[model samples]
Target: MSLLLSFGVLVLGFHHLQSIPDSWSQHYVFVKFGKEHTLECPLQGEGISWICPHNARSICSKASTRQKTLHLPNLSHKKSGLYTCTNALHQSYSTYLLIDEGQDLLNISCTSDSYTSSVLHCSMDKPFTGPSLLRVRSYSSNMTQEGKEMKIPQDENQNFLFDIQLPNSCPSEELMDPIQMSVEVMSSHEYTSRDLTFYRRDIVVPKTPENVTFTKEKIMWSNPSWTPYPSFFPLLFELTVRYRNNTIVTKRTEEQNYSAKDVQTIRVRCRDLYNPSSWSPWSPRLNVRA
Candidate 1:
């Protein structure tokens, strides 16, 4: 009788462990809008049940469950949320569903003035005309920066600008890892969030080459004043020169000095040689003759 009672207690403890859900085992799924998606339960057995996304009333009601699998057809933004599947033992697994509309309403871009600058400038283009709230956040391996929630006002050109101050400059060792940037826009009837991941070298927009001087025989320019340790980071300079006969000549070189003749107008741009990024904007159009 004593042995029988000990076996019963052991069974009860195992049942209790099975009834607890595993919160750490979560998954994320991204499905395009107006598409079909299927979710499967990790546990296999009878008496499997699913708790569909709460926001999708229609889907929750119509979703078909066959054993450990859930089939969802004709997905929409409303179908985005947590989906949980539970077995007879009450062991549950959850998946967060994300619905992508395919159409991106926010045109976002990030650029730094120089490799050594600590500020990152980001601009978003508003394609739709309406009042909305915008929130931005940036994340590095070590830290997360949250931007203040602001109302997006009507702009003449439909563009909004924001800046993020990094804890370290672009070329610093701390920023060598990947950084994540996210933007969320919310309006009365719509809500969307976009995330972008990039490395520091990917967004460096060096300052425009300065002090462009041109002569009949050669043209010379100096690197941007903000460039620190110019010897360590080589630059590739591009020269566009127009001749007297309305002809144009474009040349690329690693050196700051170039030899040319019959040049009417000249402008220069530079980019990093090792980790090339977007070329700096053409130095203010320099007219050699005028």
Candidate 2:
């Protein structure tokens, strides 16, 4: 494959050639390394010559074509380029040859978790035995933002999953803003990339839960609840408490035992999922007695 700027371009007779006219048949094909390729010459006749893209002069000697067909076996880096065929009158036909060194088996699938938009899950069809890295980027309102490389464990299936959290206090304009996400899978030797464009209007941070009621195992602590509504996306709830005993922030879960702690103060907040870094502000504090 043409891996760098110097190796990737179409040049003809000194100046850089961008494209050919339709009359030229515009034959362009990609060949993998160590593969055979055949180039068909147009306007057949005698004194036929072939010119390689990198070199200025025509190829001479035994490296000639037969019956307007040039057969190349075991393709390599030295064989990669635009090949031009010409007649004695200087009339010529050309084809752009691209060398693909990347593994043809590589493919990626990326999807936002239906349970939670914050969590983007991606996987590769081909397993990479070598060093591998997965990178993601988001573009919104003409600005591009990038996330940290997610850990892709070398597993039997080569599958990977990760989540990205959006800020809860993000402005109203940004909630519905379009997000362009590009995911790249790289190996020690070769790499491939793909892009996804989406937006989150229904997945904005959840409003703070309300209706505070308290009970005391030791110090009275208020349990807050919100008027439940139908939710389209995954949601996570956060609780921030400040009391005479301690100040703490924690997510609500079935295993949580808040009454056991000498909780003196109480407030709460919640957000729709995307592993967002920010959360809703502390709600109005409840007067709980010790």
* Candidate whose TM-score is highest: 1
Off by over 4 Å in 1: 1-106, 127-129, 154-158
lDDT of 1 by residue, 1-290 (tens): 22221111100000001021122121233355667866767776677777865566555555365356666677665565556677888777665554443336668989887767767898988744665567677777767875646666655768888887665434655345777877765433234568888876788888889999986588999999878878656799999989888899899999988888777888899998877688998998878764
Question: Could you report the Cα RMSD, in angstroms, for every candidate shown?
Answer: 13.2, 12.8
Backbone clash numbers for all candidates listed: 0, 8
Best by lDDT: 1
Clashing pairs in 2: 118-274, 165-274, 165-275, 165-276, 166-276, 206-271, 206-272, 243-265
- Per-residue lDDT over 127-191 for candidate 2, one digit per residue giving the tens place of the 0 to 100 score: 34543555666666776664657545555765555555432323345446665776654432233
As a whole number from 0 to 100, the lDDT of residue 15 in candidate 2 is 20
